[model samples]
Target: MEAANLCAIIAHVDRVSIGKRLAEARDAAGMTQDSVARAVGLERTAIVLLEKGDRNLKVPELVQIAQVLGRPLSYFVETPVPAAVSRRSAPSLAHASTRVLDIEIDQFALDVRALVRLGLLSGAERDARARVPRSHRAAEDAATSFRRRLGLDSQSPVLNLGRVCETAGLYTFAAALGESGPDGACIEVADDSGTVGAAVINGDAGSGRRRMTLAHELGHWLFGDAYDHGASRDSERMISSFAVHFLAPRAGVQKVWSENSNSPIRDRALAVGVEFQLSWSATVGQLMNLALISHAQHDDLKLREPRAGDYLRLGLSWVEELEAPYLSPGFMAACLTGYTEEKLTEARVLGLLRGRLDASQLPQIEARSLEDLRQAFMGHGG
Candidate 1:
């Protein structure tokens, strides 16, 4: 009985410690108990009790909390709590209200890193990260540098921005973050040598928004030191400007808008969209930022959405494709590598792909004969 009592006492103490850590993590994440509860699908009292060690805590629930709070699972489950949790005085809270969408992005970055570390995702071609300079005109500098390095003229459309970013050593993925969530988010991963090991972006936004989101997220990575845990309005605007210029250079706008469409602002913006694959409003805003369009002219153009057949009428050819792999690049590449190396079973690969893609979209990989490769690569050497 005494031994059982001592064991009970130790268990009770552990619970108390977990409760304290939970409370601290919640505060640091700048979330209220209610918000955390809502995210974890628990009632407010449940969160309170869990934090106080009065309620049972499950592993999955704790993990969900860690994700919602942007705290690592290790932070909660690992021994020897961090100093921030152990200190007598409460550490200063981060931004009191971060968009939950950003928190989801944070989790996405973590998951990608984990997958890459586990060899479930390919890390090939990851060393080409840009050495971006910091300055007031950082966005402009980045835009110019990317164009020059990639041999892209201002008018050249980024036919595949997702592949472009991935080739540039940024791990890009898209997820349906819901309408209320942010269109995108970026996180920077690095090593002790100050090398950017990996960068991640959530570009689940629609085609137009996805392009802009990729630029904005890349801007955050190139200009800022690291991911901004507490991004402010000004910082958002700055990166937004970078995105605008990166996707639609001043010269490109002038060349496209001047050649065909020159009248009302809406018409000019729509014309830019047709040429650039950008949202109409963003194209107009970029023109305004570059002083190509005056405020009066911008105001005069009625802001409206694209009607049906707008792309066909405008000669935008890329829109006809039913689906593009913006969100599945990393996973797809990893699955391919695994299958080719015989590291993963075909059933596993198909099952995983089915989650991210339609069953019909999944491909069957068969070993190609040397003759087939020679014919494919050497054109039969005729």
Candidate 2:
């Protein structure tokens, strides 16, 4: 009787530990206990008890809660507890509350953690952050230096910013951060192997706008400011300068300007916008800063922004590849590999993919039953 009572106490303690994690994840997801209860078809009081560790959680109930919280089941069951991810916002969005953005970023980090644990993804060494003074000129110089490091010529357009970032050891993803949310966010996490940097861009933003946000976040990562509690106005300005010059180097802009010397100032700005994949406003700003166009020309050109037709007419297609809630190719590939190897179940794989890939889209595979897992474990015993 005493042994049975002890077993009961042990089980209760486990559930209590899980309850604590659930509460933490709910808060990180910006969900109220009542909201989670409603989403899980439970009464508010039930959620309160569950989180308080006063009640047992069934497997099915936990599964439903996992879906609502946007977390993997393993995250709740894993030992050593999940590390708390810090919220780091872009300077432009420092004023706005980033609860939703924080949720997406946190989920992405969890997915990365799972992949790395499964041996599906390799850990990367942390890159040293660049030190740039709090001046626009210094920022531009740092941008030029970074461009050189990437082996990009002054005239090269970064056709694949996402891939470039990944190659540079940044795990970049996209999330649909609605219209009012931040343009992007970034954070670096440390694991047993090493540290990894991840950034989430607002996939809902325009292609040019999205790319700019990504570049801006990349600047934060390079400057090692993604871990800062809040970005200062001066830091934001320097990073903005770095991003602009990083995307549209002066020498490249000069070359394009010289190529279109015969075109009107407005036309030249459009050409630069297309070539560098910069937003209309950024293009005009670059032209003005380069002294390629007068301040008055800059003002007029900004108003006479290029239309959608202008981009299509100029042979630039709207690339939806980076749309929000999207995963990087490498990450997606690792998830798929883990699924095919029977290391991850369908539900877990779907969670890791963030619903970007449907179950129907997944390749059919025979999943191991509980008995099979038990037998495999027994076989491994000496």
Candidate 3:
């Protein structure tokens, strides 16, 4: 009788510990119980019961939750590595209607945090936000700074922003957003430690749009306020303004922008668009914003929008077709570092990559030597 009683007590304790860990993991991932329940195909009561230690957890349920939270199942059995979230953990999305994307964004940020906590991702070298001054010149100065750091002037086209962002201590990676998903989202891992941590840019967009989104997300990281009920008027303007100047600097635009009425404005927009690898509309809009052209002129340019063939006629290659999905080379390097050091297991590393990346992209992670078993024991014990 005593043995059975002791067994029951032990079971109860384990349940409670698992419950506490689940709650913490969800918090670290910045997801609410409702969001988690919805993601894992459970009722809200199920998540509540699991967290309160009032219900027994199924193995499948625990595994599902681990993947959804972007955590390892082992995390629940052991004391979890604490997540280092910015005091402001909410994401600053360029597209406001992104409730559909909350699950993936939270998971991505928390996963990166886990890797950083494990020392896989090295400490951030610098904070892009610190480089910008808090004045009227904020956007312009930030654009100049990024350009200078990227080894380019306004006259030079940004051939690849994914590589440039890595130089600024930002990890610009891609996450799959289904056809109807937001263009991009960014989460800056801020700690009291002052390391810029990391950021991911959604890359399921067209290649040109992907570059624009990376610059837009940079605006969010540099100057975005925490999740407001709605994007405040001033905040959205600044982000858009920053993206414009950063990706298509005013000086660079003037150098490449043609004002010849005889030459089709669509051709002009396409020319600049091809060079900067940005959306034609956005490129033209920046020109209008700089007062280089009138609003009416922009409208007229839109009328004869250049087709894909038009770009080929000018001997310009289709950049969008040529660019790969925007996964940060730096972040991928860290994952490899952790695996090489045996800090992460083969299954664990591949699992994390498979969850965040597409099948076609899986080969990159697969190519790594995850066979290292040296650090396999690192994850043992709470």
Candidate 4:
């Protein structure tokens, strides 16, 4: 393509991928072009130029921008660019390997939402209007009210925590949000690092670790919401506390322990793990938080942390065989509002799904059926 045409194509892709208006989605999604530019390793002006169809972009550059936008590469070229000149066919490009478990995690989040809407669970997104408090107590109160509004008992064990998060409008993804931050974050998935889920469990971690990581991130979403900008050890602890309370409420843990005084706290913890479908470490954390186990006991248990891989394996098995589909509310919202693959593809070429996924991949998937591409990408039986 000619230089001017290339620039126009780039601008058009940005408009579609990011939405009709780049400024609007960026503002609404709470992002700055500079931040996005930095994430994509481009000059700030380059972002502006690209957004305005004034910069000529190479395919590789387009791919980087798409990653920043939280979209696949197929998003950019499937329609406007003629099929004869397309870089690659949709199925071949879609077949590029991804972490299967990661895709499963994203799909799981989606299924969870489906379950909630089906009346299998109850929850809601944290109000975008609620005042985020600096005080710990205030944050807790806000979190409690959020729980109550979602019809979740303050002290009830969360039977399906992941499902609860999806019902709250988070887009769970397999990709980690980088190393500097916590295991995951709740930022605007597309506008930020393309992460939508409560947390991004490190793809490299064993399954059990991923599960804990997910719970940890879920704690953030439940308490911190999208307004909280950064992650910290203190914030992590507070969210951990929130996760414990949500999973094994103080009252509930006390009630269980009261019935098993003769049983060792470790044994009690194990039982709680089974009853609440939480990890044993999580159960122990609940005991420590509730003062049922002494600090020394808590420390001892911590010294003998259970293998996260074991827990992850069991959890995956359960999710696949017994648990219902975990759908994402965000995906549902996008689908319901007519944000189809074709639309996303248009955005990709224009640089809208710029920072989300590889722009090159967008065209491949956009030209192919999502189901066919999903099967090729994931090797999923269905």
In terms of TM-score, the best-performing candidate is 2
lDDT of 1 at 306: 65
Q: Per-residue lDDT for 1-382 in model 1, tens only?
A: 0122333343445666677678877875678999999999999999999889898776667767866875555444434312212222334322122334343344445444444644665453322344333332776767877777777886666666766666555656565444344565555543222222232333344566667777776665565433333554466566677677777877888887787664655556677876677766787677777787788876654355667476557655435210222444755677666656656555445433434655455556679889878877787566
Task: Write down the RMSD of candidate 2 (Cα, Å).
Answer: 5.9
Per-residue CA lDDT of model 4 for 292-379, tens digit only, reads: 7888898898777655464454342222211112223444334323324333223423332212435344434336778878887787
Candidate 2 regions with alpha-carbon error over 4 angstroms: 1-39, 49-56, 68-71, 74-84, 88-97, 126-129, 226-233, 312-321, 363-382
lDDT of 2 by residue, 161-236 (tens): 8877776556778887776677877766567755666778888877778788888877877878644435455787
Worst 10 residues of 4 by lDDT: 318-327
Model 2 lDDT at residue 128: 55
The 10 consecutive residues of candidate 1 with the worst lDDT sum are 81-90
| Model 4 global lDDT (CA atoms, 0 to 1) | 0.48
- Model 3 over residues 89-128: C-alpha lDDT tens digits? 4354335434324444555555566676777665455442
Q: Is candidate 3 or candidate 4 better by lDDT?
A: 3
In candidate 1, which residue pairs get closer than 3 Å at backbone N, Cα or C atoms, i.e. clash? none
Model 2: lDDT to the true structure: 0.75
TM-score of every prediction relative to native: 0.61, 0.79, 0.69, 0.49
